[model samples]
Target chain A: MIARLRQTVWSGITARVRGTWDSVADAIRPAVPGFGTVRRGHVALVGVGPGAIDLLTLRALRCIEAADVILYDRLVEPEVVALAPRKARRIYVGKEVGAHAWPQPRIDAKIVEEAQKGLRVVRLKSGDPSIFGRVTEELTAVRAAGLAVEVVPGVTAACAAAAHMQLSLTERGVSDTLILTTGTCREGDPLPESALHARPGTNTVFYMSVRQAARIRDGLIARGVPDGARLRIAADVAKPGEQLLHCALRDLPDTLASSSISGCAILMLTWPKEVEALSDPTVATETVAPVSAANAPS
Target chain B: MIARLRQTVWSGITARVRGTWDSVADAIRPAVPGFGTVRRGHVALVGVGPGAIDLLTLRALRCIEAADVILYDRLVEPEVVALAPRKARRIYVGKEVGAHAWPQPRIDAKIVEEAQKGLRVVRLKSGDPSIFGRVTEELTAVRAAGLAVEVVPGVTAACAAAAHMQLSLTERGVSDTLILTTGTCREGDPLPESALHARPGTNTVFYMSVRQAARIRDGLIARGVPDGARLRIAADVAKPGEQLLHCALRDLPDTLASSSISGCAILMLTWPKEVEALSDPTVATETVAPVSAANAPS
Candidate 1:
């Protein structure tokens, strides 16, 4: 009976000491610049940019290094995750096209539970988290739990792909507007109606549209996009084995059929010949193979 | 006469030695990773991102460090320019909205002239060099001069503003597409017709649009966009004095009039009420004050 009473007293003292330590740390955080001020159980949604470790912002790297728990997506580069402290717990919650290792609700619950214990949590995503990142659902759940949250933006895939090709999404008197859309939708969800048509003097970039190239081709053609319009397809941008393919709008399907590209591709429709002709002649001729030669039933 | 003859002969010897050194360096550059293989007098068009030093990619930093001369835009942060070597020549070619300090053609000629002198050049721009960056004109001139050129992408203002708000540009079943356009055009250049309308399930971000808020409001209203639609104006995004303003589409003109935002602002149109209601309640209530309360007749 005496030993049991002693053990209870020791446990009480330990809890008090930890509480004191946490309070002291909180007091010092405000004085340090770039130090995470995330409240006990707060979450930071950080964008790591498109695969290049150097693209990570200083604020993002600071937050990752300070996190106690990190949940990362599959598209995030391994080099980026290495920036986290060695003692921090790393969890992989990546969701593939047909496979979701940890469903959305479960991931949300895990973050909240960890935060409740007063641990700093970070959810790392590839590219800018605001673009097709399903950030709304996660933000809703975290805020509903009454936890503090902040977002750090990173470079998206479209920007990286454009950099690779030395191509601009907008040019004076050529293309004044840029549109970002996806050709594929969820199983029961239908594609947006506006995406079915292409507007003149506008550059359109379709994310995750490689699998539906034929459908995209037909939709654009039906909406009066000329068959001879120039298009660019970038696969595995900013990584080893990166490939860039240029073709006429009608030959996009054929180009993909001959190539082995299954993941992380972007399709961009650029300005017409009239505007392109005014630009560099070298760029005009880089990939200007005859349409008949590219599509001659090879 | 003897002194002049000695000077000419010394210059000839120096030129020959420099040529040999450049040939040797070029031969070894291809074998080194991250080392630029730019021939002497080549130009690299690099995007430095939206003013944050950490937002600079590894490739961009490397290029800057290796440059003999750097021509930077006004929007690029000073912290980023500090990354260049101390001996590198820094040139300010900033172009303000109403002030054309250095005309486009002059800037283009300067870069080519420097390259012709066999100096490695880096043309730095804020945000992605391709999007509304007038890259085609500069690129055409550089290529016509027979110089090597490459482009490096950076995070644009739209992505940075969305990140600052912790809001996603594309959400499932809400906004499936994102459009980026400008509100003001050059003299005699008409605004694109389709940009005036906000499509359902599409999020539109207008760059350099704060000064033209009244025109944007009238155009959208005429195109069937509801006056009650939610709008966000982000000023000086990702900068030290960054500010975000939330108001209805009808109040946008008044909001800008009341504030001191002239340039470096992004206007974003989110999803409609019906879709927003289906999402988080906190987001719904965060900026739902009555229009009259937000803008009293005082």
Candidate 2:
């Protein structure tokens, strides 16, 4: 049966080739309207998961190795950058705090120039390239250049931190709605109302907004969310400095300030599984004994 | 500077060791807590990414290798399953339509039994093990069995499918919300109203939902989502047999039915990027098309 299927497919392909050549002679084909279009260099936007060598996708690794030049950032871990061939030209396009090192236009220009040189160029970012990674601007730039572009996804840090902490972002009847946003807003931009008005069974994850932890906590209080809602502050996820703090949002500001943890941080809030123990009559009292707060049920 | 910091940390650690355990008698006392005081055979719930070897994280790999027995399912690709050590006993807990799959309670019992035997066991699932993969139920069961539990996350398919298609779920001002939901509804449960009521700037992703494509499309249209909203569908992502179909939601049902796309599928909806062509004003009429329901935009 398999042999018959293969033979049938081969016959179909041969018939098409023969028919095309017969219909358009070589002389006439030379004058065809859409001939001799050259293929352009392709751009692959790849993600390096949360500063860890082992966390990178195999497909992402292959893309980086095949690239002629790699545009990387400080957010990408050193080990991940090492995956690229030694001969591949590397460029730093990272934007640090108070510094827009490479402006938008210039970065777009660099990508187009490399592609025009017929070189496969890769734009590498930390975590999943799509989430809060300014990928849309890069995509628009590449498309405008008429170059083919693809994106390789990576492991985002929220999942990494939550997994390591043995917590489910969407536990049944706990957190069904999961929201991903940044805690820091533009100078004139208002804070996210979703974080402020957190529903009982929803999980909110904040990326790249550690400095605004206090403001986030205050907003939740103002919106009537329980002050004792669980908050997980994870820093340097999947890296050596990896730290996971389990606390309530109300006290997160003080707790984080007391600790010297800085650098890229992810903040997560959800109705925690620990709270479910409050329903077990025998264990409810003991579970809430540790630190009862304003929202604790009587 | 790094070396100096390391030395300072070491000195502080040494000072604590000397100050806390000053006498031979103190050293002779139990150096650690009793073994039985803490339960053993804990379950480590893990996610292996969509059928690609590179998609699995180093942490997940380590956890899988450490397990004495592995309980895995069909969502886990064959290539990934091969990563488990040869000596480890692997058990099939796959759930397929009308298949003799192990019930949730049975799987939970198996984990506990193996863990009680002092064997490291991994409960592995495809995509992020925690996301709609029943990790929470397993966690609760394991904890109730008095076993320690840990979670190691992998890349979720929703993000991966989007990346593979070179599409961004959120594009700043273009889209503010990205919602991911499983396609299945419980017996007697009604469809989600929020999911049906599509917001223009919000992107929605559905998993395990290819069979419901027709119903999903109808639900969206009935809920007042613009009929011109674009839909991108991909099946068997990151694997050989992968197929992609791009079209508008209004036409998605017909497209899927005619295309005969089944098996693992990812569905994406996005508000088109509205851009004015730079080179020619005429291009505005050609490419800068209005997002009217009259045209299929995907």
Candidate 3:
């Protein structure tokens, strides 16, 4: 009986969102009243994708439509922010390129204060919140302020870029593990030693580390990572003028150093099986000659 | 012009589904079609969240409704499978606790073969495909078979479980990073070292390793993880009979050792600050006493 009722409500939501889904009108009529108004104190932290509104999830769209206030960041597109109810107040807490626009405490206070006012605020962010989006902090602060929070997951730029490029982060016997890290940490800290020693089967995703690409490469090499690993840099994934570069780790620093590509890029180090399968056999022969010379114990 | 055309198509779609979304129906028309249809040679890897259909993504729900054939595993609920078009063939490739149903190689072959026939095949997984679902392998195989594949992201078990418990994985300075790793590797390989050392500012998610909780706890302790860190285990999130146990790593083995909680589960290790911020301080001081010893230094 509960299942039947749920089915009705589900269909109702669908029908309410898209007329084509109205074929189940008979199944949806009864559940309409229950979803009338969302409860107050409920917060939806939504990912707005790289910069395109098209990549927004349907739930994210619905949640935004119902918001009373939208606390958005600089990275979110103007078009996507426009989705919030017109009457809903829009607050910008986005950080400037080099400066921290809004401090952490202020953002937390805003969430708590708005939620206290019984507003369903959508804390809009760019890409997936689980990554370096800094959602964990805001959600923590809000919860501490005695409010309810719901995270509506969004597509991360890494996934979007990978999908756009038809590249697999992991492949059988090639790369079986994926590591996501941040490159925004200060200079002296080099790549984490353990991450540097990631098994050959692993792929690493470095977020917000575009300017530090050369350092990241040097750090990885210092940690004993092979110079021959395949590295790809994806910037502005999903944006109209998005850029991507596929090259070897040794050459990546030079390939991207002088390039004008900038802003919130993801650096992916992958051992693609396709490349291994498609590489010119003569290239492998050349690589082995040098590798054997280096490995020949003195 | 393209945006307007897309809006036209979307408005038509929204009108067909929900009639109109409030007074601004004109402003928020469908920019794209609802429930994206799978094209030939394209595999939609979807996650049917825990067991509850309400937790399923609106897009995932539509894909399942329109699937030509659903290749599902044991983790997917029977009710979700029933949602597929009545005429859609349902192939069970799930592995029961002790029974080896269909090996992965066979499943991959079937997906490739079906796609080759131009059938819309949905590899319906229980949780997020990018995580432990091994959708990567399926993606590689299908693409190798000369078919297009698109992964429809779903609510990972960790997020669902966290949502069920109203917990935040990353809370401010308490936890800045969220690392997701399986509890145990197949064939007795050691637990991931990163998961064990879960840094002071990181949250670790363990999937499909509930049975080996004791070993996992031991590994963490050996890695010098602080005893004060917070640990939470949620089994069968969003489903009936869901269970959540928030404790320290050491106490987990004893608490869950004798009991068998099946289905999907998520083990989260978070920083103290994040936990303190997200949890009710009063409730934390009371209910968490028993497991306080979990943080006792090794």
Report, for every candidate in turn, its global Cα lDDT versus the true structure. 0.71, 0.65, 0.61
For candidate 3, the lDDT comes to 0.61
**Each candidate's interface RMSD, rounded to one decimal?**
22.0, 23.6, 18.7
Candidate 3's displacement at residue B160, Å, is: 3.7
Best first by DockQ, ranked? 1, 2, 3
lDDT comparison, 2 vs 3, better candidate: 2
Measured against the true structure, the TM-scores of the candidates, in listed sequence, are 0.78, 0.71, 0.72
Candidate 1 residue runs with Cα over 4 Å from true position: A1-39, A271-298, B1-39, B98-100, B273-298
User: What does candidate 1's lDDT look like per residue over A133-209, in tens digits?
Assistant: 77887888899999988888877888888877777887666667888888765557876543442455677888888
Per-residue lDDT of candidate 3, residues A1-298 (tens digit): 4334334444454445544323333334454555244588878877665665545666577777778999887788776777666799999986765676987679878888899888898888787666566766677888787788887655666656666665555444445455566656433443332233233345667777676777777765543345666678888876656788777677766887777677677888753222222222222231101111111110
- Candidate 2 clashing pairs, residues 3+ apart or interchain: A58-B54, B41-B115
All candidates: DockQ? 0.18, 0.11, 0.08
Clashing pairs in 1: A41-A115
Arranged by TM-score, best first: 1, 3, 2
What are the clash counts of all predictions, listed in order?
1, 2, 12
